[model samples]
Target: MELYQLRTFVAVARAGHLTRAAEGLHVSQPAVSAHIKALEDELGVALFTRSARGMGLTPQGQALLARAQSVLEQAEELTRAARSLRQQLDGELKIALNTDAEFLRVRELLSVLRAEHPALGVHLPQNMSHFIAEEVRAGSLDGGFVYGEAPPQGLEAVPLCSFRLVVIGPLAWRERLAGATWADLAREPWVWYSDALPCHASVQRWIAPYECRLSKVAVTDYEGTIRALVQSGAGLGIMREDEGARCEGAGEAFVWRGDSLPMNAYFLYRRDRESDPAMRAVLAALRAVWGLEQPLASAHMRA
Candidate 1:
């Protein structure tokens, strides 16, 4: 019945946890419960089921989520339109910068948004690729830039660019890494990514089925950290070609430059947010930052 109740329902469903949804909504848990109860009673169907870990949506709740999100978005748009009629266009969006903000042309993205929507407020937070995807899907973040083979569930991903990921090491090890094979690289002590990082699996796939156990000298998830360790002769590491080249030119490191691995970059957001004008504007700005409109027009996207 009430828009507030519907919002609470949507938040609960998205978070799959009552407390988290309550915190995100900036309301007390009891209030969140009351809202959910009222909505369920009004609709004559149970919307959630309780479990030890959290609350989960029932089939009925799942069915209503899309419709609820659409209603909320439309209502928000109506309010924005009314404000626009008065010559004011106010908006605030939270965006995640996956891995490192430096790698994604972040300044360009901001410039585009500022030019189009001067009143729009933007927040950038550093986050992992997988976490960024999850936050975007849960409506916590507007969108994020990530590198991967594909986007996760409930998201729409558009290709931004493709680049080579290269194996790199300290310049001092140039002789050691030369003509190194997968088996040789694996046998050498290396700077490796933590198992939890999204890039970890991709790095493994880069040398598919090699099944060689790397002698990990240092483990980390941060790209800058990995580069630093690799350049310090901590061991070998995999990184973007441009980054490796920069380090090589600095006389700090050497890129393998043998067979390079390819990685695709993409911008990800929830499909439900597609109808949002601000989100649409953000998407356009992102594409523009990549130097074209619909640059990934033919790129694959998950439904």
Candidate 2:
């Protein structure tokens, strides 16, 4: 029933183990266990099933996990709101990035924000797209650029750029695909991403049946590695048209830009944090750089 209990519970649920969660929270194993036991006793339901392998959330636990996350998120937001009310733009502007495109925008945004809003500080937290979304919602990030099908719940997504996806291959691929269709990309050896990455699921669908038997010369989470593998004669891989242009083999990189595989890059933040003056200036700087300085239309997002 205490805040620490809930925090411990959330950490355990996220880590799916007591020892790891305890280490992350800087607490002892018994302390974590006691907190969970106390929480379960108060709630009158078991949250996790203890086992030799590891802890697994029960049906009740899964149900509580959602509400627990929301509660913890809101609690942190409350603290941030109070802090923002008392002090304006004094803290770091915590931002997150996922893809290379998102990462590329940071230096520019930081330089502009610093020159314009000298009172404000900036922090970059490089992580996957999903974590970027989650941290923004949890008030751990002031703003960030995330790539996904849609925005995370309770956060506004300001569309910055939209790029066309392409299936990229080396110069030699041009000879084999004299007249190739979207389906033809599936027939070749595929070098795909692992998981929890941008466009992984879409890449899977694009490669379809061939993904089962296709040789995965490089299973990488790094975009640079994928590009390197493709350039080093590994196999065909998925990339954005802009990304392909910046990498090697720009002239002979077999690109399928006609496939309308578009993804919207978004700058995300908590809905309540929009009124912060420093945050506004940071956003304005970005808009000025991107030629979107004109007032943005009112948008209330729900994932």
Candidate 3:
């Protein structure tokens, strides 16, 4: 009946697990369960079917989910309208960062935002790029930096920059990998990224024409872990061009001179919130920091 209960219901429905929904809502599992139970009792119908696997929305729940979501959107719109009337922009904006703060220019971005809207607070949560996109689309995050060929549907993205991914190996492997071709590189032991990462797909596509299977020794999503493993001679890894150059310059890793995979980084937010003042403020700061011109009407996607 309350907005919190509806929010919990939507979160649980999307997550399909009590613990995950609780974590997303920043509440305890018991609290989430109680909210669902209370809502079901008040509505006189079962919202979800519980089992060992996870919660599944019942027929009625599925039908009402859209309505509940609409209600939440309306409530948020009302809040935004009220805040817009205030002389100063003041609220907490949660943004997700997919990489190190320095590379993202987060410090500079924050400084600009603070100077422009002193009352506005920002929260930077580090996460994977895809997860950041999902959270932004779901309205859990205000905006974030994501790396991909294009932003996901329902989101507007401003192109920030691009980086090429280069293959890197331990310093000891330099002699072994000297003048190595794609086929030769494929034969080497690899420290691969998780399939969930955007770079994983890029790597896969990049190597597809080579038609070779990699000997994966380890799999991880963290760039730091990949760098460390590669440095310790665990295997080869795909790293950003600048990072690979830094490691190579430090004599820690060897960067392959072969064709590199190119990727674009974007600042993404829910397309529906483009007109919101707070979102506009953040976007303006991002543009200034990235030295980008005024975004075109369709700049959200590259031609």
CA shift at 298, candidate 2, in angstroms? 6.2
Residues 1-303 of candidate 3 have per-residue lDDT tens digits of 799999999999999999999999999999999999999999998999999999999999999999999999999999986785564689899999998888899999999988878899999898998888889878999989888876656678888888899999999989888899989988889999998887788789999999989999999989999999999999999988999999999999999988998998888887778889898899889888988888723245422
Error of 3 at 295 (Å): 4.2
**Candidate 3 at residue 75, lDDT?**
100
lDDT of 1 by residue, 140-202 (tens): 998887777655656788777888888998788798769888888888888887776667787
Ranking by TM-score: 3, 1, 2
User: Could you tell which candidate, 2 or 3, scores higher by TM-score?
Assistant: 3
TM-score winner among the candidates? 3
| lDDT per residue (tens digit) for residues 35-150 in model 2 | 99999999999999999877889999998888888898999999987775565456677777777635357677777877755568877777877778888888888878877665
Ranking by lDDT: 3, 1, 2
Model 1 residue 51 lDDT score: 94
Clashing pairs in 2: none
Compared with the true structure, all predictions reach lDDT values of: 0.82, 0.75, 0.89
Task: Flag the better candidate by lDDT, 2 or 3.
Answer: 3
Clash pairs (backbone) in predicted model 1: none
Indicate whether candidate 1 or candidate 3 has the larger TM-score: 3
Residue 152, candidate 3: Cα error in Å is 1.9
Question: What TM-score does each of the candidates earn?
Answer: 0.67, 0.62, 0.69
